[model samples]
Target: MNRKQIAVVTGAHSGLGKEFVKLLTEDGTISEIWAIARNKEKLDQLISEFGNRVRVFSLDLSDRTSFSVIEKLFLEERIHITYLINNAGFAKFCSYDDITVDESLNMIDLNVSAVVALGLICIPYMKKGSHIINIASQASFFPLPYQNIYSSTKAFVSNYTRALNVELKNKGITAIAVCPGWMKTGLFDRGTIGADRATNNFSGMVTPDVVAAKALSDAKKGKDISIYGLPVKLTWLFSKVTPPKLMMRIWLMQQGIKP
Candidate 1:
């Protein structure tokens, strides 16, 4: 019998990560899955629920030292990673005045730096048909008012993923970015800001399961970028025609926040 293809997804404990884990495990295409997250108990529960198909890896994406541990696993394990999904990130909402240097730096560390580092670390181990999917935000298409830092980080992720796709294409490694709009995940509820605002304006929000399914399907098709939801698509289109300053002003006004 042929060995099942291996897939690795970070942030597997909750939100879209959990959905991805569930979908991929049930998909007959995947043979093995490495569910990486910081929560050991949740990982254990996921493994128990999914049975022997899923392997739990206690990973904290923001930790620079964690790469070495992952590296050790890649080298020692005989599995070929068919897919890598960088889905681990946190959301912080604060105006520039209220945002601290440490908070801003942490956002960059987790959302941008760690993602790039993970891609680089996984590249050497990735086989020819391997694919990498980075979970960015629809905020990448426009400037968000209270969520400035998080939005900017996602913008960077989206751009970086596209640029990297070109470089890896010749080698048969596909890199794609998934840009999803406001998702009904615990991210906002557990965030430092924007939870109340998001709840009040939840009409356009998409479920995490929907987003994850679309992302996986897009990645499998080798799509360069996947932007989820109609409102987000319209916002992205508007950003293309509108000037940066004007767009920022309009977005802030819509959010009832000042530019």
Candidate 2:
């Protein structure tokens, strides 16, 4: 059987991941999408909406073994991968001392390790015009006090993405790191735990659809960074020019974290 071209998307159940699924489905070059996430029920719902073009995998990306499944699929099917969207990541907002060691490590495992592993695994299958979009955060632009571990993982993502872009340029594969600000997703509540949700509520939320739309367009153009919103663009600029200490101070003040 001649298998169809594939697009692999992680975190495919909701928010940006869901939007990415929709965008990829519209691309006629890719006929099958392998959607990976831990939420089987949500995956089923997404599959219901998109039909057989969506193949759901209920696996946790945080586990090192999970990535092996992807390699196995590629080797067995011998299909070309046109897009690899590494969108599965999470952030726990709170002070360092307050967060447990296990919690911090899990963030690193999901937000950093899994992303790196998948990038290494997928690049061999992807060729010119193929795109890999890694979901980073604007929080990565500076050292965030309350969101320390999460933001640090994102910084690694941003730096690694740029390096990967340059390396892949010769091969015609484009790798982009998308650093978006707060969005209207369920994760917003997770981030505000033990902190005042109202503190950062002033910035406003960007719809995941907008972020997904802009990212897909930017990825096709071979852009290194894809960011949404004027506020987030300005924040990225501020983080670059301002000193680390000043950026931390500003973040703390904005998040209602005391000195």
Candidate 3:
């Protein structure tokens, strides 16, 4: 019997990551999945639930050393990684004056650097038809007030994915950026920015399952950029027409923050 196709999903412990795992596993096309995350207990529980089809990897994406383990697994198993989903990210809300340099840098590390590094690292293991999905955000469409670092990181992902998609097209490898708005995940509840009174109003957003479904569907279709939901799409359109400074001022005012 032919071996089933393999997929790797980062941030698989919760939110859209967990939903992606469930959706892909039930699709009947994928036979094996590597659910990567830092939480071992949650990973183990998912493994138990999904049985032999799902393998849990205790991975900290910020740790560069973990790439070697992924490389080794790919080679030894002779697994063709048909899909790679970069879904791990964090957010924080702080005024430009209140946010420290270190905090901003860390967000860059996880949100942009890690995503780029993983895509590069996994390239060798990915076959011609493989797909790489980078999770960006609607914030990429415009500058987000008080959540500057997080918004910038997602914007980087959006632009990077699109550029790489064009470059890799010749090689038959597809890259897509999945941009979703206000996902109703613990990401906000557990986020530094989401806890703030200024940002908490944006809570109770769209569900993870909906985002995952739309993203996966778009990935399969080889879309260069998938912006989910009507509100997010409109936001993207608005960004194109609105001047940056004016938009920034408006957004800041909406958040009850002075620019």
RMSD of each: 2.4, 1.7, 2.1
TM-score for candidate 1 = 0.91
lDDT of 2 by residue, 1-259 (tens): 7656899999999999999999888888898999999999999998899888999999998888998887888788877788889899988776677767987898899999999999999888887888989999887898877777888999999999989999999999999999999887877666666744223544767889999999999998889999998999999888779999998887778867678
Q: What number of clashing residue pairs does each candidate have, in the order they appear?
A: 0, 0, 1
Q: Name the candidate, 1 or 2, with the larger TM-score value.
A: 2
Q: What is the lDDT of residue 79 in candidate 3?
A: 65
Give the per-residue lDDT of model 1 (tens digit) for 1-259. 4444788899888889889889888878677889999999999998888878889989777778888998888777666678888999887766665656876787788889888988998887676878899999887887777677888899999999999999998888999999888887878765656443321333478899999888888877888898778898888898899988898777666666543
Regarding TM-score, does 2 or 3 come out ahead? 2
* Better structure of 1 and 3 per TM-score: 3
Off by over 4 Å in 1: 1-4, 97-99, 194-203
CA error at residue 52 for candidate 2, angstroms: 0.9
Top candidate on lDDT is 2
For all predicted structures, in order, the TM-scores are 0.91, 0.95, 0.92
Cα distance off (Å), candidate 2, residue 65: 1.0
